[model samples]
Target: MGTFKIEGGHQLKGKIQPQGAKNEALQILCAVLLTPELVTINNIPDIIDVNKLINLLKKLGVKVENIGKGSYTFQADEVNLEYLESDAFKIDGRGLRGSIMIVGPLLARFGKGYIPKPGGDKIGRRRLDTHFEGLINLGAKFRYSKEDQFYGVEAEYLTGTYMLLEEASVTGTANIVMAAVLARGTTTIYNAACEPYLQQLCKMLNRMGAKISGVGSNMLIIEGVKALGGTEHRMLPDMIEIGSWIGLAAMTKSELTITNVSWDDLGVIPSVFRKLGITVEKQGDDIHIPAHTNGYEIQSYIDGSILTISDAPWPGFTPDLLSIILVVATQARGSVLIHQKMFESRLFFVDKLIDMGAKIILCDPHRATVIGHDFKSTLKATTMTSPDIRAGVSLLIAALSAKGTSTIQNIEQIDRGYENIDSRLRAIGAKIERVD
Candidate 1:
């Protein structure tokens, strides 16, 4: 456990590179289990969750090689199929939510897989029904032990079939797709998630001999193949971190250049920030945010009504970045409603912001209205506890903009997603120090 002490009111200015997409890296890492060949992945972020998943793979007997910085070669030919039954398996599986994806590939290859109840950010009730139901549709028999909180699935041989997901869950879609890539016959998924992460996974699988079509659409078709070969894949820059940096720059009145952000992948994030009157300049593959002068007003809808920011499936604002948006809005010139449609308890962290002298009304568990101080009243620094990954970073941004100094405990929550965040922010002149 560690804490971050930040001296606020500094105008950060510099160029920084966003880490590889954590979501994409998690899904891509799980895909490596589908093929026994030497799968090389590049641009992998060095974060806790991704590293934990990699470590889990290593313990499962996958051959892991540190080819270079942020790169690895994985071969699952030697994966110990019996390891899943050990007590350690449940411990590792529950460490992070991404470990749940390992079940799909394992079940596809070995006809059996099991996972303990997964642990992750307690944003809301993230159900595994979509995942289990989709796998069951593919000819897998699933069993849950309520007492032990264990989830297990097995099959003689997975047979492909049609599945319409209850929701286009990002991880759920990735899991089902991985299982479908090896099953016999064709698999069709309607209402599938088409995020860039899933697209990258499908592209990599296709390169490795999986017949998958409809890469960027809500519907996907997969013709199961008997085997897959190794392929080299690179992860996309994290769009969530990019959005966070943009919010940080706006909140701190800093001029920042985010390098190689994969401009085309950031759907409506730039526009959403622009809605708050922050100027985002797109140059080639980079995004430049100029220092903002006070007077940032929340843009009312064309109907001339109150502005509301909410999350939906891909092509919509991601729920992960809603906390950052809420914090940035605390300094904007107008009040706006933040509706976190997906997660029920995520917005509760706004209470910490309220304690920092922010004018926010917590309407309920999922919605809050923030009235910006617009720099007329500088936020007073205070000690706080970092909750989850996204909320931790959001509070860090708030601390950077607040007056005097603030201390944040449980910064490990922040480190789980953002790679070397304190060091990276310090490079850009942020007055942040990490203490053990």
Candidate 2:
């Protein structure tokens, strides 16, 4: 376990580049199992979750190699199905929610797939029923083991058909897509998750000979093929990371230029942040934030009311970024409501901010109202522990801009998403140190 000892009240300056999308990279890595040929992926973020997924793939006899900096090559030509039943495999299943996606591809290629209850942010009841239901709809059989707390699936031949997901679960949508790619017939998925991450997965699958239509919309049409060949694909830049960086710059009143942020993919992030009064300049694929000349003002709707920022499925404000947005709102001029509809416990982290002299009203488990003091760096830092990926990073950002020295324990939670965040923040002029 490692901790971050950060000295706050420092401005983050200079230019930094956003790494590959962690969410996209995880799904694309699993997409490698859809092909037996050599598949090389570029712009891979060397994050903890990605490495864990790579290790899981290697254990299943997939040849994965770190060919270069931020690049990886995988060949699943000899994937052994036995590893799916191993206890070692089940132990790592809960590492990230993306691990559940492997179940679909493995079951499609082989006849069976086994995974323990997949783990991710303990925000709410993230049910795998949606995932299993979609697979079962495609002629897959499943059993549950209460003793081991694991789930298993088997299928003879997947005959795809029209399926409607119970909810727009991101991982569930990716799982079905992987399974349907090699199925016997066309699979139509409605109410799919069309986030940028899933979009990249669909595009990469298409490049490898998988016929998928409705790339950007909720309806996905996948024409099953016999097998898919390998192709070189590059992951998209991390929009979540870029959004976090933008929030960091605005909160600290620092000038920064984030490079290689696929501007086309960041559909609603810019406009949402702009609603909070953050001025952003887009030059090509790079985003520039100029030291926030006029401090951010609390956004309001046209009805002369304080603005409300909430998350929905794709094309809405991402649930993963609500924490960063909530923290940034603490320094805005007025009040805005931050509603995290997807998770129940995500708003609990606001207690730390309230302790820092920020006025926050915890409306419920899923909602909070933040009245920004525009506090002049008066947050007196104290000891805190990271809860999850997004909340942990938000805490780090808050600690960096706090008044005194703050110690954050269990920084590994932050590493799962943001790659080498301490080093990256240090490069951009943040006064933070790592202690093991």
Candidate 3:
């Protein structure tokens, strides 16, 4: 296990470049398995999860060549589907939910796909029933074997049709889209996830000869084709990390600029942060954060009352970022309620925040009202362990702002998302050291 030791009360000041999104890179990598030709991807985040997925792909006989900094050429000219039966092939699948996405492309290209149950944050019950249902609608046969704890799918000829997902699952929608791209007919998907990551996936698939429309909306219309070719793509900068940097600058009164941020793709995220009293200035592809901000006051409703911040599916505030927003809100001048509707267990970390001598109310598993103390370097340090990626970042925010030294353990969860986080924080003057 690894931990972060931080010396608090130092302001982070400097410019930083955000890393490529881990979520988007995962789906795009799996899409590589759809074609044997060469696919070159640039700006790929060098994170733990991305590395794990790449290792898993290499074990399946995909020839991956590094073409320089943050660039790689992947050639899956000969996929050894036999590896799907080995225990080594199942290592990444059981540890990350993104591993489940490989099932769709493997089945589409090789006629058969074997995948074990996926593992991710235990925030709630992440069911694969919807993924299975979506594939079955595409003329695929599914079988579950208890001996291997694997789900097998086979299809001689896949035909696409209309699919209404049970929920707007991020990876589930991705799996179905990849499978539908090469099917026999047109595929219509309703209530699909339209996150920017998904939109990028659709665009990449289209460049590879899959006709997909409504890229940024819930209703996707995919015109299936016989085959897809390899294409070059550059992964988008991580919005979640950009958001975290914004929160860091606001909380620490630091001047920071995030380079290479896509302003057009960040729908509702900038406005959401502005509502929390954070100002974001966009200059071309850069997001500039002004220094020495007083942690703006949360604006009240028209009736002059407190307001609330909540999360929803795409086009709304993302649930993954609410934790970071809440931590930032804790230093603001007013009160706000954070309602996490997506996960029942995400708000459990507020107790740790409360133990740090902050004013907070754990209304339940789904809601927490945070009162900003504006301590501004008055909080005493403490020991805590990270629970998830987003929460881990939030803890780092808290640790960085505390009055004394603080220790945060189990940073592997954080490494799964952010790339070279400790070094990046060091670049901005955050006094954090990583120890194993």
Candidate 4:
């Protein structure tokens, strides 16, 4: 396991540009399989998870060309469907949770798609029911093999129908939409995840000749086409990373500017941080967070109730940043409740923050109450392990604001999401180094 040795108590400066949206890149890369022509994608994040998916695509015989940094052209004209049955594919498909998305496009075009049970962060149980059920609604057959922990779907022809999802799962919505794009008739999805990334996916599909409407709403209507053609697409900035950078600036009392942050798509993120008494200034498309020298404060409800921040569907605060908010609150002037309703074990990382001297009360598996220290006491640096991607970055933020050097092991979890995090932070005056 690699480690990050960070020396805390230094304020970071300079501007950092957020990488391309990792979530969007995953879905877009899978969508490339729907067409046999060249599909050019720009601003792809060079994170571990995305790289894994790219390599997996190469193994499946997609002709991938790296035209430039963060740009790639993919042509799936000669996809080796036989590779799906190989043991190597079983192992490769299991290495990435995003690998499950490839099944949708594969099943749509090739009549069959198979994947080993996908692997990702151990935050909670992420069920594939939404994806499979949506496909089944479109007249696909699903099967599972408990012995090999594999899943497969097949359809000689898919007929579109309406589906009201049980949950607004982002990846689930993307997978079903990709499958539905090539179906025989019209398809309507209700309660679909309408996050910016999903909207980008829908728009990209439309550019590829698929007739999809309601680009930014919970209800999406897709008219099936005979075949999709290749098209170029550019990904949005990673909002989760942008949120993390904002939290990092406040905790370290730093003046930092995040550039080109697609402000309109960042629905509730800026306002949510503003609720924490942090100044999220809008300079064109950039977000400028000034040094919180006097320390930021948490805002209470007008009715004098302790402010509560929770996750919901699009236009709501993302659960991915709840850990960042919780960490940022540790140094704020007031108290706030963080409810991580999406995952049961995400809040368990608060114990690591407690060990670092933050005043946090883990109310339950899904909730935590944080009482701010207002920078009256600096966190004491110590050794810790990264539990997951978001929590790992949250702990790294805490370490950067601590009084001394800290060691964070299992940093691979962080790399799965963030692109060259240590190097990027160092460029902006952060005292962090990677120890391989």
Candidate 5:
């Protein structure tokens, strides 16, 4: 396992650019299989999960070429359908959760799609029923193998229909839309996830000759096209990474500028950070965070009640950044409650922060109460292990603001999302190094 050795209590300055959105890259890569023409994608982040999916595409006979820095062109004209039954494919497909999305495109273009049970963060139960159920609603026959833990969907021809999703799942909505684009009739999806990434996917499909409307709305309408053509797409900057950098600047009392962040797309992120007393200033397309020399204070309700930050669907705060918020609140001037509504085990990392002498209460599996140290007390460094991607970055931020050196194990979790994180931090005067 790789590790990170960090020297704490150092202030970082200079500018950092957020990488391509990891969530959007996964969806856009899977959508490449929907067309036979050349699809050129720019701003592809060089991360483990995204690279794994690209390798899987190559093994399936998709012709892929690296055109430039963070740019790739893919053509899936001669996909190897037979490879899906191989033992090698079973092992490769089980490496990441994003592999599940390939099934929708394959089933839509070809006649069949198969995938092994995917593996990802051990945060909680992320069921695949939403994906399969959505495909089944589009006239596809679904089958599952209990002994092998594999899922398969097949159909001679799919006919579109209306569907109201039980939950507004991002991946599920993306999967079903990819399939419905090639169906026989109009498909209307109500209660669809309107995340900017999903909206990007829908807009990209429209550019590829698929008829889709209602961009950036909860309801989507897709009209089946005979075939889709090639189109170019550029991914947006990762908002989650941008949020992490904001928290990092506040926690370490540094002045850092995050460049090229899509300000309008970052819904409620800036406001939520401001609620924690951090300065998120907009200087054109970039976000400039000044040093919090006196520490920040959490805001209370209009009725003078304690502040509670919770995650919900789009237009609400993202659950992925809750870990960063919890870590940043440790040194703020007042208290805040972080309610992680989507995943159960995401809050379990608080014990490690508590070990570092931060005042935190693990209210339960879904909530945590943070009592800010207000910079009067500095966190003492300690050795720890990373449990997941978000938690790993949160711990790294905590270590950077701590009083001494700290060692973090299993940094592969951190590498899964962020691209060249240590080098990026080093350029901004951070004392972080990768150790093998």
Candidate 6:
């Protein structure tokens, strides 16, 4: 594990660009296995999870080349199917959750696919039922071995059909879509996740010679084709990262400008922050967060009830960002409740913030009440450990506004998503150092 030593109470200035969407990159990289032609991708984030996926693709015998910084060209024309039966895959596929996506394209292009039980952030029980059930509905034979913890799927070829998902899981939708793209007949998926990341994936597949309709809706119709061709794709900016930066600016009294944010795609994120009384300015393509000298305050609803911020599906405020919202709320003037409906364990990080002098009550595993300090008192720095990717960044934001130097260990969790986070923070005048 690595550590970050941060000297707090310094306001930051200047511009920073968010890397490519981490979640999107996972889906896009796995889709490379769908075609035999060269698939070129741009704006690939330099993060640990993404790099791990890239290396996994190479180990599976996909010809991958780095064209430039954040650019790569992949050709899956000569994939080694035998590797899937090896013990190496059983070990390699367990590193990240996105590995589950590779099974879809492999089953589509070839007759079989194998993957080890996937692992990711231990926020809650993330099930693979959606992925496996969707594939089985498309005429694939699925089986799991309890002894090895391996999932195996095989079929002569998939036959597309109509299926309604139990939940609109983002990665589950991507996996099934990849499988359905090459299956015979037409596949109609209802109750799908239509996040911009999934939308971009559908668009890229359409450009590669697949027919998919209902790009921006919960219902998607995909007509199977004999084979897919190669196409170039550029990932959108990371909305989660942009939202984090906005919260960081307000917490530290920094005037920060985030460039190339694709403002139209950031649905409900800016408004969610603005509800916290943070100053959010949309200047063309960039978002500007001015220092709140008066301190941010929570806005009340029309009925004069205390405000509540929670997570939901796509159009809803993303569940991934609630941690950032929770940390930022500590410095606001009024009290608000944060409900993390999706993951129960994510709220446990609040104890660390409370130890830093912020006023908070852990209502339960899924809820927390934050009473803002109104900038009247700064948080006292202390030693802490990062639990996961989003929580790590949230703690970093809190530490930046604290009164003294704080040491944060287990920063490897933060590096899994954000690319060059320390260097990026330093560029904007933050006093953070990376220590081994």
lDDT of 2 by residue, 156-255 (tens): 8999799888899988999999999999989999999999889989998999999999998999999999989999999899989999999999888899
lDDT of 3 by residue, 142-232 (tens): 9998876889889997898998888998888999999999988899999999999999999999998899998999999988888899899
lDDT of each: 0.93, 0.89, 0.88, 0.96, 0.96, 0.95
Model 5, residue 99: displacement in angstroms?
0.7
* Candidate 1 RMSD to the correct structure: 0.7
The TM-score, computed over Cα atoms with residue i paired to residue i, of candidate 3 is: 0.97
Candidate 3 has its poorest 10 consecutive residues by lDDT at 372-381
- Superposed model 4: Cα runs more than 4 Å off: none
Off by over 4 Å in 2: none
Worst 10 residues of 5 by lDDT: 125-134
Tens-place lDDT digits, model 1, residues 1-436: 7999999999999999999999999999988899889999999999999999999999999999999989999999988978898899988899999999998999998899899999999888999998999999999999998987999999999998998899999899999999999999999999999988899999999999999999999999999999999999999999999999999999999999999999988999999999998999999999999888654778998999889999999988899999999999999998899999999989988889999999999999989999999999988899999989999999999999999999999998988999999999999999999999
- Candidate 1 global TM-score: 0.99
lDDT of 3: 0.88
Q: Which residue pairs collide in model 5, if any?
A: none
Model 5, residue 80: C-alpha shift (Å): 0.3
Q: Which regions of candidate 5 deviate over 4 angstroms?
A: none
TM-score of each: 0.99, 0.98, 0.97, 0.99, 0.99, 0.99
Candidate 3 residue pairs in clash (backbone atoms < 3 Å): none
Clash numbers, per candidate: 0, 1, 0, 0, 0, 0
Candidate 4: clashing pairs of residues: none
Q: For model 5, what is the error of residue 314's alpha carbon versus the real structure, in angstroms, after optimal superposition?
A: 0.7
RMSD of each: 0.7, 1.1, 1.4, 0.6, 0.6, 0.7
